[model samples]
Structures are given as structure tokens and as C-alpha cells.
Target: MGELVSTPLPTQFGDFLIKTFSSGNEDIPHVALVHPEVDFSKPVLVRIHSECLTGDVFGSRKCDCGDQLHLALNQCGAEKGVLIYLRQEGRGIGLTNKLKAYQLQEQGMDTIEANVALGFDADMRTFVPAVAILQSLGVDKIKLLTNNPIKLEALKEAGFLTVERVPLIGEEFDSNRNYLNTKREKMGHQI
Candidate 1:
């Protein structure tokens, strides 16, 4: 991966340096929002978030993605952390398939069931790119902001020296209760 560009971004959460990382073929590059006061000497706070077009952009209540993202941003802003926005929409199934999966969900399938029906894994996302981004930033240790055990495991599997998990729980809503249940029950998310 190569860092294509970086610039200062002032958001309501905080002022940050946004860097774009691309693998050349991807039209949408992964991004890292770094707080101005971020320090590398100690374990830095980091959040590796996959893109959720419906939830993150349009505020869909089918899942708690948008809430989680906002919470992460706020925490990152306050703690001088980094938020890596990975372009792995729908957990790597892409937007169209994600929409299709949503249709299936409306027909009574759970998230994983819909993805499987679409002939894809429950979560096809890879943490390799996120790890690469962190490495590029010279971040050896991290206090990962997430409730997904997969994220913590991914970092350790990549041989990250010190990886601590910081819980990032999203608000539970009636619309997303089942969705969250599937994640916590079937996918082993630490909710």
C-alpha cells in the first residue's frame, strides 16, 4: 500500500490529519484520521472501521455502524488517536451485494445468512490493510477501540507487540437488536 496524500481535516469531533492509503487498483482508498497530538512513544489508540455506506452515510438503523463510527471518532478526537477507515463496505461484499443482503434480511435472514446466501463468507474483510497502515505510521503498539474479538486477534496474529482492546459499544436499538445478537452470538463479537 502507498500513501497517496495527506491533509489537515477539521471535523466537529476534532482537527486531524487525514491520510489516504491505496493499493493502486482501488478507486476508493483507505484513510487514517490522525489526531494532531497523537503520540507514538506509548500505545496509541486506534480504530479500524470498515465502511458502511447505508449506516454511516444515510443513518440506517438496520445496524449500529454509524453510532459506533461516531463514538470512535469522538473518542479518537479526545484521546489523540487514529481512526483507520477501511473501504471494505458490507464486510467486503461491496455495496450492491450489501443492499442485496439487506433485502434478504428483510425476508427473514440474519446478516451472516444473507451473506452466505450471496455465496460469500460472513465477514470477508481483511485486517492486513489496516495493519499495513499502522505500520506505515510507525505504530508498534495500539489500544484498539473495538468490541470485535476478530480485530484484537488480527493484530496479534500480525505480530503486533502490544495490542490492548478498548471496548467500543454501540447503543442498542429495536431495529438492530437482532443484528447485534447475531454478531455477539454467531460471530463472537464481544458486544
Candidate 2:
């Protein structure tokens, strides 16, 4: 593990303490946005959101990333929890490949098909960094906010006890209905 840095981050959601786990090579490190006063004894609310440039920042409805990010932020802010923002762009395939996958999707392929067509898995993210962040914060149990069962299993496999799995069901739009369906049917996401 590289050096972890800490900083103050006051967002619209609330004042938070941001912790970054340096990867040594990436400019944007993995981050944990924690509410100022959290109760570690209880099942803390947690969201491990992968970096999504188009949806999270620009409000693109192509995927549910933007909505889910904001939802997690609000929940964390109000509930005094943590949000682990991973630096895994486009499910770890990087942005360029994500865009190419989008191009394939435009040609009538589903999201998973698009990724496969572009020579990538549907999801390439791992939860080791998230586990490290949680452990660094002394959080062993959490009520995870996610629709992905893989995330839940990964956390459990990483030795974190999940007290609950909070479903984050984002509204599906025409732009992402197929994508969302693909996640539900093929990828086993709860949606």
C-alpha cells in the first residue's frame, strides 16, 4: 500500500473528510469520502463507486453512474457513512475503450456485448482498494449501497461483514434501458 493522504472536503451534501489511497502511477487516486462523525460500531453505509466521467460529471444518461453517485453522496452525507470512489474508469477498461464500446452499442449491441466486442469484460473492477480504504478507516462491517451482487460478494470475500445490501435502483431512461436490462439479466445486477 502506498501513502494515504487526507484532506477536508465540504460538498453540497455536507462536510466530509476525504482520504486518498495513492496507486503511485495514477494522478487520481482511490478516494474515501467519509462523513465527519461516523459510528464505526454500527453497520456503516458504504458505496464503492467506480469513476464515471461522462455520467458522473457531465450528467449523461447513458448509464446510471451519475444518479447513483449523487444518491450515494446524499445518503452518505445524511447518514454519516463513507463513499469509496475508485479510480476505475469504465469498469477498469479505461475511457477510450468505453467510448469504443459505446460505439459498438450504437450499432445495436447491448452494453455487455459492446464491451465484449471491444475485447473487454462487462465489468473489470476489483474491490481490493475499497477493502483497504475501509480497513484503514477501521470499518469492518457495512450496509453496502449497490445493485451489483459481485460488489457484495467481493466485500464479503475481502473479509468485510455486510450487515445489509441497500439497493440503489436508478431510474431507467430510453438511452440506457438496454444497458440496465443487460445488467439485470446477464450480469446479475439487482437493479
What C-alpha lDDT, on a 0 to 100 scale, does residue 177 get in candidate 2? 89
Overall local distance difference test of candidate 1: 0.92
**Number of the top candidate by TM-score?**
1
Clashes by residue pair, model 2: none
By lDDT, the best candidate is 1
Relative to the true structure, how large is the alpha-carbon lDDT of every model? 0.92, 0.89
Residue 63 of model 1, lDDT score: 93
List TM-score per model, in order: 0.97, 0.96
Clashing pairs in 1: none
lDDT string for model 2 (1-191, tens) is 44377788999999899888875446888888999899999999999999999999999899999999999999999999999988899999999999999998888998888888888887888888888888989898899999999999999998888989999977789998888889899999997
- How far is 127's C-alpha from truth in model 2 (Å)? 0.9
